[model samples]
Target: MKYIWIYAVIPVVYSIMFFSVRGGFLKSAHMLNIRFLSGLSIDDGSVRTALLVIFAANIAAAVITVTGHLGSTAEDGYLLREDYNGQTYTQNLELSISGEERPIEIEVAPRSYSETEKEAILSRAAMKIESIILEGQSAGHINQDLKLISSYEEMPIVISWVTDRPDILDWDGKICRGIPEEGTDVVLTASLEWGELEKEVTIPLTIFPKELTGDEALREKVNEAVSSSNNSEDEKLILPDKIDGKNVVWHSAGSGQGLIVLFAGLLFAALFMFSRIQNRDIQEAKRQEALLYDYPHLVNKLVLLLNAGMSMRAAFEKTAHDYRISLKNGGPKREGFDEIL
Candidate 1:
């Protein structure tokens, strides 16, 4: 009979927690319910049934939440924000892939671009190639120094152009020949081959000529005279000795201390939870022990009432009434007598 009250209290407590509590407090109750249900022995059929009901309720709530059946008002409010007006909206909603199409086992060949797309791609590539060649030609033209240097080799030209079918596109290096003479244009040609698609671009280069005569000899004599003067000046230079200094050492602190602290914290938390569970079990055992200890006395009182010309129901009621009065008068509340009441 005492077990009936215990069973009734469990559901009542669960109801209050589910309806009244919110946020982390409610989440903690859910976790505790799951843990308690899992720890119950298989032989305890009544307790197991109660636990199953609570577990099922939690699962149903979770399902409703995930399926967007719950909290519809809050979702609608968030979606109606002013910032979302006239803008595309996206959400991280869960989707079921069960009905999606599956891949077939048949041998299917890879896809290639259509003819129109290939032509558009090739035209864009040609424009990019022409721009690069023109820039290279302007940069590579000899300056007043009359020396020729390939600008293409000095700085790598980055080609931002991409083809739809990169595997088929083949690019050959630009070809130019012969020294550029004064007043003559050097033509450089570049070729790109993709399958049957081919494109070629030609650019003309110009050279600026400067006469070379007695100026070379005069420049050499001036450079030699400047070198001799610099050497003599360098010989007269001096150095200073005896520099002051201080030596300091630094030691790095490792993560070992943090790891130790983390481990200690985890150990303390584990022990605390273990102690709480053990204390709860111990208290329950003490309660059951007290009930068993008072059972014989309660039965003896019931027998005395019955023997004094009282009916069975009257004797039971008298025993329960006396136990309640004693409990009210600061006596121990016997579980066995309370169950009878």
Candidate 2:
């Protein structure tokens, strides 16, 4: 029973000291929430109730923060499928031109082939290459406009052609730019050199005069406007009335300082709580020692009274009575005697 009381009393006393210290600090700076924090300082059942509520709230908040952090990390692609699997995989992740653009699909498969079969596969791949379109031109008219088609691939392609009419359609190393006087079929051979392997493709081209329609002209204008808008310095500013005006600019205000301050406050609170809880056993032991120091004197008085021939109940009652009188008259009170009484 005494051990149980000590266990209960230590926490009760710790709670009082914790709340009083916190309340005094907060009160000094006029930041204390009286309605909430003040209840813990009061010597009543409400203090225990408040502690229970605070503990439950902190646990709930911690759970929510952890869950949210995990969810956001997964959504942002920080978590990968390969993390949980033992198989290796590769992905070509690229940003889309527009949000609605579909991702490019690549397939990987294993096959055993002879050298002849591999050469046949390369030959088939090279024959599949069709006519190459210049950067700004549409696919319909290749002959009317002599546009220089530059190499857009990461590795430059070597172009060589044997045309029936070399004078009409000519090829420079960089670009194919020549106006054909009449409509004629021309064969163009382009080769890509990668390391020691060379892949060649033949392209059939027919050039004719192209007439621009009203809709096509309007489309070209719109394309030009979009391109100019993208390249403009004021692209971030938005002005709906002006077609070339920019969208609104957004600047990020980072939370580094705020996070640092918040973490520091949490660290301080944790340290304070740990310090108070850690010293609880020491404080309880000290209190017990003080009470035990008075035990010898208390036992001696009880022995004297017992030797005086008084009854056991009378002697016990008289001992308690004397302690009460002393306490009431401002005399020193011994904790050991008080417990016995």
Best by lDDT: 2
| Alpha carbon lDDT of each predicted model | 0.51, 0.55
The list of candidate 2 runs beyond 4 A from truth reads 1-252
Name model 1 segments beyond 4 Å from true: 1-17, 20-112, 136-183, 207-341
Judged by whole-model lDDT over C-alpha atoms, candidate 1 comes out at 0.51
TM-score on alpha carbons, each prediction: 0.25, 0.27
Steric clash count of candidate 2:
5
lDDT of 2 at 288: 93
lDDT of 2 by residue, 1-341 (tens): 11233444445544553465445533422343445554434544455466656655655665675565555433374434332114454444433566664555333232334556546554554553443433444333453444334332322333333445455456641223234446556665656443344676655666554444788555555565556556467647332323335444345789699999999999999999999988997888877997789888887888899999988888888899999999999998687887867
